[model samples]
Target: MFALLPLRRLLICCLSLLALAGCDRPSAIALDQQVYIWQRQWRAAHAQALVASHADFSTLRVLVAQAHPNEGWIQARIDNDLLRQDGRPLIAVIRLDGQLPRLDSSAIDQHIQTTVRNWQASGLNLRGVEIDHDCANNRLSAYAQLLHTVRAELPAGLTLSITALPAWLSSKALPTVLQEVDSSVLQVHAVSRPEAGLFDAQLALRWANAYGAVSSKPFHLALPAYGVALTENGDVESEAPLPQGGSRRELHAKPEDVAKLLRDMQAAPVPHLTGLIWFRLPLAGDRRAWPLVTLQAVLHQQPLRSNLQVTVQQQGELFELRLVNSGNLSAALPTLIRNDAAHCESGDGVQGYRLQRAANTLEFVRQSPGQLAAGQSRALGWLRCSQLDHGGFRVSP
Candidate 1:
């Protein structure tokens, strides 16, 4: 008994060391949480929100939805909607179902953290952090472990959420919800079906109940407002900017159909609905879809325009650019053509515009699409080039 005392003490010391090592593991939730934090900071510095109340992640510029009244919005226009409130934390999105963007965890962490911090320094308030991505039911264990590691690393007060598929909540995977998530979100828009189709709204509601039952936190459900335009066979028609939402134009959905869908949602009973998230803002609601242009006046400060489209194809013998200039007369005047996607342009037949040549290609130096007379349209001459590998050809005017 006397000899066992030292051995027992040694055993206890070893056990304590083991516990400390376990505690030192990084938290997966925390890692992603930081990513969201950096994104919020970036948004605050980069983008300006229309509604001065709170940062609206639901805006078209979702990626940079961290801007607010105090922080100035970036002069550039890159439309996205990820935050609904002003200067809030970024919702860092990572797709777990598919192959990893890259294998190295360090690489992933560095990239994510750098992005989040850059955003935060920009002036946006880093409040709510979210990761929007898909994960399989069977692989939930690995994902849960990752989340646990991340949660350990993340700072307090930063909200964490994950996007879960309907199949994940199906009978078998439903039970593991408690082990995996802090808060959950159900994406009503289905991305996958191995054989036939996705779970309906009723089925989705049941999954929500099951998920909410298992987890202690309050989870939210996300649904699309303008993203559900379908073809004759229920396939997505076209992913265009919800008329005037962003750069999207030449969409197929009829103007009247916008309000019609809203009416249907209101009539149907969506229960346990903490809040409704329009999956996307600018892409779903544009000036045409609404009455008297309330959304446009409030959201978009200037005239709405369809995204500039440039189609490069072989026409007869000369290289051709099938361009669609979409915007009302209010945006700008169009005078000269410019191509910036490629540093080279084929300005064989135009004057007053600048062009640069490098190695073996001609590039457009500047653009003045706004120079065109408002409401009027014109097509400049094409460059006659038989060049086979013309991969660097684009048109902008």
Candidate 2:
């Protein structure tokens, strides 16, 4: 009996050691999701409310905007109506302006801790905190120090993550920076130059490989579902400053374009890549973002087809040319509408559409680019033609 008891003890110890080793290992390879809520309001009637109900996400990162260098972070308050009783975890995101002065690390830490406490007191599901600073490469070392301090100050069971720019992958301080955080989100979609596209698939692949080869901690790729537009302020000799939110010169990326990029990344994924985190959760009131249905199509690898219909309405002296989209997604407005005719001119919405004379045809071009949504139509301008019916007008991208 004594000999049997010693053998049983030995086997139990061996099993416990194996269990500890398994616990220390990396988590299972499973697909997860994280979403960002950039806006302040989160009412039950918000578009994100529908998204939250439909999406299979693990977390929601809420934006805390800091307007100026010295301004305190403005944290967003979540409406209980928008979240379920047992909702997905929340990550408080602090967005700092690139041009802001260096922040006091101690003060920032206190601010974050206080914010976390407040969220906890509000009966919210707070999980982590993320820094969304586009720090310069030269300032990476300092940024690393700040991250370390912030990580240390975080409460038990809470994590620290940061948004990493592509430039950070090549910095010497990247290793030091990653050492302090639980994970990082690399923003693959960006609009640096006003004329550049929303994202570059090739560039994103290169960054994924480079960062994956060096990064020790798991990272997620951040993508955009929104659009941007750049307009000149005035007819100045030099370039003018970019417009504010109220400006109408916004640009957008087609849902097809974003889908193609996502497919490329999926085809050639990197190691330690956690998952994708969309730049924003679109709201019903947002004019610059694609609809949630379009975003879902992209996620499911569905292609968007353009359905353009041109109709003519006779309004006494002139005919109005209208373009309509009756498909599942949006269609980019053509730069010009051409017809080999003599009597076509600008329509009633001439401020947004212009008249141009081609070599053999009259053309009406859009003064600004716009997106035509499904079941939506826009009047290009008034067409002055003898016949009332639509005849020879063709759209050109």
Candidate 3:
């Protein structure tokens, strides 16, 4: 018994040390949330979109300029009045064409300096400038030198940042490149080939861990809030149509997947991870982007639920069918909508559905998959029936 006393004391001391270490582990902190408004053209709807997202996002990263090899520099026609009215910290983003064999460093520096001066002169609250150039990993050293020059050219009070790619993880010059900027944004979405799809949560998590391991400065993760269409000709389209004739596959970033990623990051908390910057603020009637309601819910970590209801509005012998989503999440359009009616003169499906007529029944079959955003309604079809049973409508999702 006397001999076992020292061993028991040693075991207790080790356990106590382990418990203290566990307790000392850092708790996850609330990260700052920002958004990107990448629209090249300023429209009336952009004002409303900015207002809708103003409460959730603390900073706005706006695409102010783009440099192309052939087209040279094109400045975005932003609505300065609307941006002034919105009253949020703005980060002007300058995108350089990645295909350029070499950069015009002096021209880039001049553009940056001029844009900052012009934006500030317009009474816009410009806080930072971000350079978005997806240069190859091997070109990182040259990219770093460009960043260093740009950083020096920026106004004294403004911060400088860069949009980084996961491919740079293998480059030894990554540290040197990072050293030139005040911050970096790791864009994990849409980095892979279109065949691999838009996003992979597990792979993104691994990249985040690896980034955190290497980056000494705070970095933000640029997540996708929208999607794109991949054409058979190996072309990706967003907000435009390709002239090529072929079938296209639409890929979307699921809100649930992003929410789960946020939760996972919060639980584990990557070192030097500062915040999340969602790509492209959603505007009303923007088909490719997630609805503002759904995006807001995901940002706040709210539970997602979508309730789609098929309702009928009648006027004498004419009946109109509509689908409404009352829940907070976006719902998929129903594959089938069945209704029973007797002696129907004419019936037609209006939107993305096809009308099928059978004895004593009218069926509206979806022609293609679509989403009905939360709090939105769409007209399915109309029917002119002598005797229409309003209660005989069935919806299959």
Candidate 4:
């Protein structure tokens, strides 16, 4: 390179130019700094933070209440004084549904009655007891009986509440239901459904309104601090949300996944989230698949991926099993997967598919088709059994 100007000459030229421009070196530097500040700091300071997506549940108490023969009643009150001391309304959960590990309904009733009495005795007014269930079911009648016995024998200050199912919204399904429960909590967690239609928030509103009018009672909602991710095997992947929904998408969590399910008679709405209860509290923190308890976003594991991809087509007793391998990896069908429309899937991979011999047993496919790729699905199985289930019984044990 040839030298265009010496260092001393260049420096002299700049100084001469600055003098003609009538601006000091520091003034020019200040102007450049102002430009930088406007481009960075000013924009940053003015950027809007996101608003919360979940219903304002600051006054909620997500109680994890449990009872047993000798284990004694576990209350968020005595167990966690911070919650009790704060006077947050309690959403006492009493496990009234599902297979019980020695869950005596009589014992459970006695415990609830005694607990409510004791709370009244202690001058602690409880809002409600969340009776968890897939639906009101025959359980509601039994619960109503238990509640009547309890209310008749208790102090006047206490109240009883239970979870509601959105399916109750249908007039035809509302007959054998509870007539006098105080309030109902609609779980926005997993609707008692196995499909995608039950996550609509609008359906939730109608369901809640219907039940509220039918019972002539105010309905409260229990919003989930998380969402569920299901795999092709029909297993839940993650289950909790974080403290706040992230990003600016505002695709925030809604409280009606239960109502969106037309089957849930008890769906809660955003305006009346009632006493926000986070279903059950995790003994451990969040899983990699789930989120923290109250984060707004759906606690997603990997994008908006679904884990349900089984294809079943039945043709009388002799049916073929065809499964579409929508998952990332290839898997052998241990049993012929059945659905309402089809008995088993056919093709894609069905040379040697398996089938269930007993209620819970998987046997080798009488026929043999081989390895299937991702996105490819097929099943091959036969059922001469007396009766096949509507939800498609698993061919594999």
Candidate 5:
């Protein structure tokens, strides 16, 4: 018995090393482009930059939504193919309805099988499939069974993955649920009540570390890459102005917020960490979101840049001061713009702009520090005078 001790120790050591390798932190992350509305292009150049910044692959969201509780699934079509066929593998993301019934799993599975097969036939190379379901914690068993059904029908050699919730990790059924899928994505960013903010960096770190300690399955961390404009009436809009939604209170994670998340992950990486996937890819119209450079910087663990360019432009009847961020991160503006012979007034529906009178100069002050995101430009306010390049009317440094 004593002679077998060394051999047993060696076996244990080998198993430990294999486990460590499986849990190694991500070297390459992925990007998810959820195409819900019509877009003119895919921004292939930006995607190429993402790949150059250690992005592994792109997952295009092909929504499999249900019109009614009992009705069949309706597959949303991809509009403008922004990504070029550059031989990089793409994953087809199938998102089901949050309130979808467990009884409909059979039909959903069949639809998924047909949908994936059709995607394969479209001449686009596919790397795998990801099913996004926001099922309740108690229903994990049913979800697990559904996953098994879907896996059995998937084409051989194709990978299968799922988007998992933080709450699911603590449930007793998570282990068995994990066994059904090849990989899982832990989503850390989500919409919360307006008062609670959009994301919590500390909470995300704790959850990521906890998952690493429990599960041995390879998983990706999903972070938010998009922003939403939430209004007083609780209406949400993305990128563009919402005419019917009234004034918007922007809810988004700044570049520094995302940077902190990345740093926290590196400090305490999950054991089974495969990679990361941004919640949704940014397009040109997504003015409230982070730019490609910012995303690249976060992935590479580089410091964010601050480049704010100020300019004045005249409209039909009004002259406005425009502030643009040209760097990789957002910045709080210089509070005051002082000029001796000019009167500045906040534009209609604009908050945070006020004017103060000094002995000889008028100080146009931004009462609240508003964040201006990189690559996004906004009109600060209008000047009562139409003269351009007024010497005394310069912004405070």
Candidate 6:
């Protein structure tokens, strides 16, 4: 008994160290980054945008079909040539109307099959299909059946995924629904009503952990990279011009908030959390989406900053004032701009700024709130001053 005491103590110590090692083990899953190109129409700019963003995103999830409330089914006109040239792994997404009375499983399956065949015929590197449906919790079981049937209909090489909602976390059928699909994407952004705003980082983190607990298979979190304008009549406009009628409120997800969330998630990763999928890739002229540089910086865990400068160009007596954002982050337009110029003949502001000229100072007052995307320039106004000091311009936020 005396000889066994030291051995037992050594055994206990080894067990304690093993338990600590188990507790400190890193997650086995590596995060795969992806982006969604949700544009309905593909243009030259879209092609260029895809080329620019091809390296950052591992997979491209393109919108293939959308079910409208009254227009029935609308198919997206994808740029096959561009997609083939890019040669990235593709996952076609089909959005279903949540308010639909019933599911047309057969028709949907046929559509999915036809789409896959056509894309493959076009030489696209198609790898999978993702169904984006935000149905009620009670309907999850039915949704699961639909997914199961769809999975059976897809080709052997193709995988199946679904866009999940946080609301379904409470449902007992969530596990069953998750089991039907090969993987899932938990959309935490814009899941609430319009009044609730676009994104809540804390709430999103909580939802993600909860979803990780429920989903057995690997899953991704769909985060926002764009803003939406909500109209007084309850109309939401994303990547489109708001109709000229009622008042509108713009809701945007701050980059800093999202970066903080990403850091926290990296520090303590949720279970089975595979990666993040940014919603809607940013195009050159996309006013609502974050600039590509800003998005890239956030994804790469770089610092975020915006350097706004007022530059004046002179062609003889005519001077053009412009606002230039040279930093990696988008910046809010300055509320005021003052320039010291004497003998100003005439000056007028353009693009929502009003010019006020005093004895020796030119003041440009902001008429509305706006954002200046990174690496972009906007013409504030032009000035015609005989003795203008271009170096004496000041910008006030």
Best by TM-score: 6
Candidate 3 residues 1-397, lDDT tens each? 3555587889999999999999998788798999998888889999889887888999999999999889888889999999999999999999998998798899899999999999999999999999999999889999999999999888888999999999999999999999999999999999998889898888899999999999999999999888899888789987657788789889988888999999999999988999999987988777888888888888899999998877889899898889899887888899988877567889889889999977877889999988888879999888898887777778898
RMSD of each: 24.8, 11.2, 4.3, 22.4, 8.8, 4.7
Model 5 agreement with the true structure over 1-397: per-residue lDDT tens digits: 3555587889999999999998895553333322221222334444444344334234443343333455555555453243334344566667665776554667777777776777677666666778887878898898889889889988998888888888887699998888998888888777345557667888888788787676788887877766777787887776657778467787777667778877766665567786777655555556766666676677667888878666667765466666678888777776777665444433321356676667756666787777777767776666655344543456554
Residue 362, model 2: Cα distance from true site in angstroms: 20
- Models 1 onward score TM values of 0.43, 0.70, 0.88, 0.43, 0.72, 0.89
Best model per lDDT:
6
Candidate number that wins on lDDT, 4 or 6 = 6
lDDT agreement of model 1 with the native:
0.42
Q: lDDT of all the models against the reference?
A: 0.42, 0.73, 0.90, 0.43, 0.66, 0.90
lDDT digits (tens) for residues 20-105 of candidate 6: 99999865445789999998888888888888898899999999998867888999988899989999999999999898888899
Candidate order by lDDT, decreasing, is: 6, 3, 2, 5, 4, 1
Per-residue lDDT tens digits for candidate 4, residues 1-397, read: 8769988999999999988887542221100000000010112211211012123233333434554335555553343333344444554456543444334556666777766666555555366555554534444455556555644554465466666776656544343345556665655435655455324555555555665566555455544433344455454444333344323211213322422322232222333333334332322232321122222222211222222244545566544444455543334444444333232232222356544333343343435434443334444444443344534434442
Task: Report the CA-based lDDT of candidate 4 relative to the real structure.
Answer: 0.43
**Measured by C-alpha RMSD in angstroms, how accurate is candidate 3?**
4.3
Q: Show the lowest summed lDDT stretch of 10 residues, model 5.
A: 31-40
Q: Which stretch of 10 consecutive residues in model 2 shows the poorest summed lDDT?
A: 234-243
Q: Clash pairs of candidate 2?
A: 228-251, 229-250, 229-251, 347-381, 347-382, 348-382
Backbone N/Cα/C clashes per model: 56, 6, 0, 52, 3, 0
In angstroms, the error of model 2 at 123 is 1.8
User: What C-alpha root-mean-square deviation, in Å, does candidate 4 show against the real structure?
Assistant: 22.4
The positional error of residue 302 in candidate 3, measured at the CA in angstroms, is 1.3
lDDT of 1 by residue, 272-301 (tens): 334334333332223222211222322222
